[model samples]
Target: MTDSAHIASGHATRPIGGGGGKIFGFPLRGFGLVSSLLLSFASALFTFCVTTMVAIFALLIYRANGHAAVDMAISYRDFGFPASLVVLAIALPLFLTLWIRAKIMG
Candidate 1:
């Protein structure tokens, strides 16, 4: 068949290479690594902030429902640390994964 017909029928497709091309003299692989790290860091920060805010609101709710101020502090002390850690643990990795995928695919 004709060359155009062969290519159109998927008879001339090439395999993908592992080493990606560079951009502006910077390697795409390195860019992906750096971007993933930055994204993970930002995600961790955002998750921590949201977790802290939620914990504070929960404590406030408890206080408004007749608990003492000290009770709020105690509740925060009991649960806030682990909650923040858990959020960071989950969100940071997920953000990093998505960033890496986007960078590599694009």
Candidate 2:
């Protein structure tokens, strides 16, 4: 039925999203602020994992080279946590800027 007929019958047609949605729009139905956090956090987590793995590998190498004392905490304390924080800081701002740019341009 036509839109007017549907409206008169107390029913209204709505527009379906083109696909997913735009990156930015008036209704704020895109990868807005919350999504930027999620994406930045994910990137930070990835950085943490990679740095932790490298730190652990280095510790292993040190142990193999006749170092009797190796503290596993070094991997987390010296590398992973800081790296993740730095990545999170960088990524959050970067993603926010991109999101804002998309929003403004759109």
Candidate 3:
């Protein structure tokens, strides 16, 4: 066979197309590429800061209340599944919204 490695690397002995033209039909525009990269970076930064703040607040609340929080949940008589599910549902949507917004903006 003719040099499998070269074919795999897309740089065979021959130059293939003349003048080293565009690859994959995209013109390799620079401005749009740079703008998208910057947007993605900013979105990631914002998401990370917001999520960190939320986690810190939750930890503070847990530490402050400790047994009180647990006692309150038990008094509600819905400790096991309902409370866990409610927290999961609320937190999941919040996280998902942040992620989706970041992706779209980026």
Candidate-wise lDDT, in order: 0.63, 0.83, 0.48
Give all candidate RMSDs, comma-separated.
8.8, 6.9, 15.4
Clashes of each: 0, 0, 0
- Deviation from native of the Cα of residue 55 in model 1, angstroms: 0.8
Best by TM-score: 2
Per residue, candidate 1 scores C-alpha lDDT tens digits across 1-106 of 8778889998984334335555575443434556766755665566656666787788788778997674555444566556656766786676566557666676
In candidate 2, which residue pairs clash? Answer: none
Which regions of candidate 1 are displaced past 4 Å? 1-31, 71-81, 87-106
Note the residue pairs that clash in candidate 3.
none
The TM-scores, one per candidate, come to 0.48, 0.68, 0.34
What is the overall TM-score of model 3 with all chains considered together?
Answer: 0.34
lDDT of 2 by residue, 1-106 (tens): 8899999999977665424354455232345788888889999999999999999999999999998988899999999999999999999997788678668765
Alpha-carbon deviation at 47 in model 2, angstroms: 0.4
Poorest lDDT segment (10 consecutive residues) of candidate 3: 26-35
- How much does candidate 2 score in TM-score? 0.68
